[model samples]
Target: MESTKTAMEAFEKLEKVGEGTYGKVYRARERATGRIIALKKTKLHEDDEGVPPTTLREISILRMLSRDPHVVNNQIEMPLTKSNRLLDVKQGVNKDGKTVLYLVFEYMETDLKKFIRSFRQTGENIQPNVVKCLMYQLCKGVAFCHAHGVLHRDLKPHNLLMDKKTLILKIADLGLARAFTLPIKKYTHEILTLWYRAPEVLLGATHYSTAVDMWSVGCIFAELVTKTALFAGDSELQQLLHIFRLLGTPNEEIWPGVSKLKDWHEYPQWKPKPISTCVPNLDEDGLNLLSQMLEYEPSKRISAKKAMEHPYFDDLDKTHL
Candidate 1:
């Protein structure tokens, strides 16, 4: 398939959405059916044999899971097909000779970052009720991924998308996601965004499981309530400092083998300030949920299933009740 012609045939380019390190996303319209889609065009890297591994991983996992409404509605508009595979799956080449990979997604108006900025600029707090709703939906998407044996290693505000009108939230960017329970080695330092990374990860502990994702959800929850990054820091050390400043330093009693982490030697041993000082504005119930979600021991973190059952959401109106 020719890159130029295939792109032209499948969808008409509307406008560029955002540029990443390796790709540029564009708003597009499907020519055959006139449906809007987000075309993610990635630049081929010869180092990795032209095809980007990130794109490949996303496509591979999405292919099997795309049929589910929880995953489908989040992004990747319309069902996929061979032609939508971006290039000749066999030859791995396109007409333009430049490797082209296409991921057709339902166009989103904005991301969580933009939405958060809007609310911050207006000096309006995200209502507890609204936060609860968004949290529930996010849990649904994360649970769907977990159930499918996928783990989104990278979870951040920029990757969380939303519809402008309805304020619906969806998880985007599965480039870092991997099939869960795969036999991989320990000490994989590919640390996600510093602020949202789990304590175990920052401590240089590998062999991590789905618990890393739970930590991200906790950070996101705190962000929603505080209207600021929960552990905003300039560097990895600073991020740890921020975390300890709030959650209190992890003593061996609280987190056995705390000193066993590969990088634990770097920071000085000190107890953290009280949790209340960390989030003075948050209510007890909100803080309770956040604390569980952000447990020092990944094993102690709340699962998505239990998170939804927390009493914090008891007041939510079911079915628009």
Candidate 2:
């Protein structure tokens, strides 16, 4: 396939974005188009270590998702500028000996965390209309991803980005995303951010599907409305209890085969609580939507498309493209 942008022409130098468990990011510009973008410079360690797997996984997945506008589009370096490519930015040895790689991306103004922090600094809480706009755009992006068979296993406010002009939310960080089709692959039980994880994930359910993402969507939507992390827990068990306390504990009648999960036998038992007890201030429509999203049974969780058609969004009359 033809490449989109070359390293030498992408940028010179700008400012740093942030550092994570893996690498650092910088804001840069495209020399050719004069457009701004983020240059994520990752360290390539000698041993197959922290930076390699996640870095390579993110690059591979971003390349796969390059064509989708709703997803962060990667600017691939071209072969014509192969020699001129900016390899000196970093150095390392691959499995086949010496090699180097660099990743370029469109510059995002700020992430959801930064955006919300900025809003809080001004003492102006996000309006419902603004929240609806952001959520709708985020769902639209995620819906497009799910439609094309990609599952963003990790969905959290931090992974969401907002552009300055329209404030349209874009789902960033594809490091944890993978394509899922029937006869799913056997993977680890550990996935998703602790607060945004689905109930099935906490129950040690391995055969998960798009429903996992739907649960995250619910958590994100609720958090946006409340302006705080919905189920902020430091542990797996705590996270489960937090969710149960809000949405009520799951029973065999509500979620069938609860006892058959890989780690079901050792879980603590608790009585379910009504939603009103946890979120007394939430309107009936909001509670109803959250209940559908946080459903213990994956089969019963609402799809991204159906969630878009929910009545909670009826008052949001503006189009956010």
Candidate 3:
């Protein structure tokens, strides 16, 4: 393996971009080429264990996923900082003497979450065409991941990185992602963020599939149009309630075997509301696509590939983007 120390010396650290469950990200520039990049440094605690599971998983999955044009490119095990150079004092090290791991990536200007928030602050609605483009790109990236047998268990505005100039969105933060094709250990439903979690996950369905990600895509689609999260629930129960309120409480009739999940419980009955009521800015075709993505029955949820073929994107300009 290449020493990360050498790789670290190649870039001039600019500023801290973001932090997540696994590590901190920094914007940096390469000294030789003057190319900008995002550097994610993972701390390996000396006392507890080796590299964290999340970091290991992220590096492994990203190596395969990055082969696709739509997924973010990540160079793993590449030497980063110089060996002789002193480490940045701000990024505290573990008591153990082992070196930290640095994952190099192409820098993106901003994320969809911050972009939406910026528009909201300015009281400006995102252009309809721009929304369509962004959603289409998101679907492409998700489709690519699904086709490769990887499931991005977590998909939200914050995880979608966007280049401000090109408006190209690349799916990032694959720490929670895993392969679903092969027979493996049972999965936990405690994966996705509460707001974008699917009903099956909330009901403690351990053997979930791509439907979990599709449900999140639906929530993100709505958010893009409204500039706000569709289901901003504070807790797991409240999250399910928010989903049920809009999509109606699922019954055995609407979703077979739904009542058999581990976390199943009887709750208040609420009729499904029109999606347009929440995302009024969306057109008929857009609303139809959103409905399919948010289908209560996981099997009934729209796949990312099918979503790209929806009539809502009939006139979308694919040439420029």
Candidate 4:
């Protein structure tokens, strides 16, 4: 216990960066190496059984994925280290007096949401080449996860971290991620953020697959181009409405089994709009790739690996990036 306390004391807490369902995040610097890291302090409930399921799941998935070369080499360049411990005097104390667990990760400068907001405020568009590079990296990371039988249920601009100097995009926040392999278990539709949530998930399909992540990628792609959320709905119903308005309402004919979803309802009928109409600046190839990702039918949605090969990224200088 004294050694754990010493280890925790090795890092100096810098500032609070953000908070989530599990815990608070802070920017901290190591006293020994002066290395910076993001410290995620997860609260442990006194009445709860053990470690939170989300934390266990995240730690396990990341452990398995951290071994993959594709993930370690290019995708979100952070090594997950659990050795460090910290005693939080403020928010870590439980009714039983047990301290919270702190997860240590290499520090990243910003996330995609903040990056997009900066561009929006500057009244400038992200360079098309930069978008291509970022999207390719995102697809690569997602592909690695899916190939490893993991599904990143929560994929959005806010969860995607980036190093401003290198312009490298990393997929972070695996709290909602799960393994989607054989003997599959039912998943909650209420997983991803509203704007990036897949249509099938929105309609309450509990038996979803990796295609859910693709839908989020499509939304992020559109956001990268327009510097705004493609479907910014305030509520779940409005979120569905936003999707239906743009892609047309799905039916038994178009998306088989969609009507059978638990939350399926008789939504207003609408015809699909041309992708080019909404993303006017997106070229033909970009539109084609985006359409495949945004397909209402989860089965029809393009896989992250397939998306990485789309013509939209044909000209990307992969070697340089």
lDDT by residue (tens digit), candidate 4, 1-321: 123366467779999999988788999998988988888877776667766676677777766766543324454443322111122222244445775767777677899999999999999999988889889989988888888888888899998888877777778887788888776678877646898988877877778789999999999999999998899999999999998888988888998888788888888999998977778878889999999999988889999999988899999987633
| Whole-model lDDT per candidate | 0.72, 0.68, 0.80, 0.80
Give all TM-scores, in the order shown. 0.86, 0.80, 0.88, 0.90
Candidate 2: list runs displaced more than 4 Å: 1-10, 43-57, 69-98, 121-123, 265-271, 274-282, 318-320
- The TM-score-based order of candidates, best leading, equals 4, 3, 1, 2
Report the C-alpha lDDT of model 2 over 190-280, residue by residue, as the tens digit.
Answer: 7568989888888888788888888888888777666677789999889988877666667788789986876665455567676656555
TM-score of 3: 0.88
Residue-level lDDT tens digits of model 1 in 1-321: 345565667679989988876577888888888877777776565557655666667777766556653224334342211012231222134555655666666666788788888889999998877788778767767776787788787788888877766656777877677886666446365648888899888888878877888899988887887788888988878889888867777878999988898889655656766555656677788778878888898888898778878887777764421
Across 120-212, the per-residue lDDT of candidate 3 in tens digits comes to 999999999999998988887788788878888889988888867667777887778887765544798765798889888898888888888
CA deviation > 4 Å runs, candidate 4: 1-4, 48-50, 70-96
Which window of 10 residues has the lowest lDDT sum in candidate 4? Answer: 81-90
96: Cα error in model 1, Å: 6.3
Q: After superposition, how far is residue 94 of candidate 4 from its true place, in Å?
A: 8.1
Task: Please state the error at residue 155 of candidate 3 in Å.
Answer: 0.6
Greater-lDDT candidate between 1 and 2: 1
Query: What is the lDDT, from 0 to 100, of the residue 37 in candidate 4?
Result: 84
Clashing pairs in 2: 37-107
Question: Which candidate would rank higher by lDDT, 1 or 3?
Answer: 3
Best TM-score goes to which candidate? 4
| Root-mean-square deviation of every model | 4.4, 6.5, 5.9, 4.1
User: How much is the lDDT of residue 252 in candidate 3?
Assistant: 95
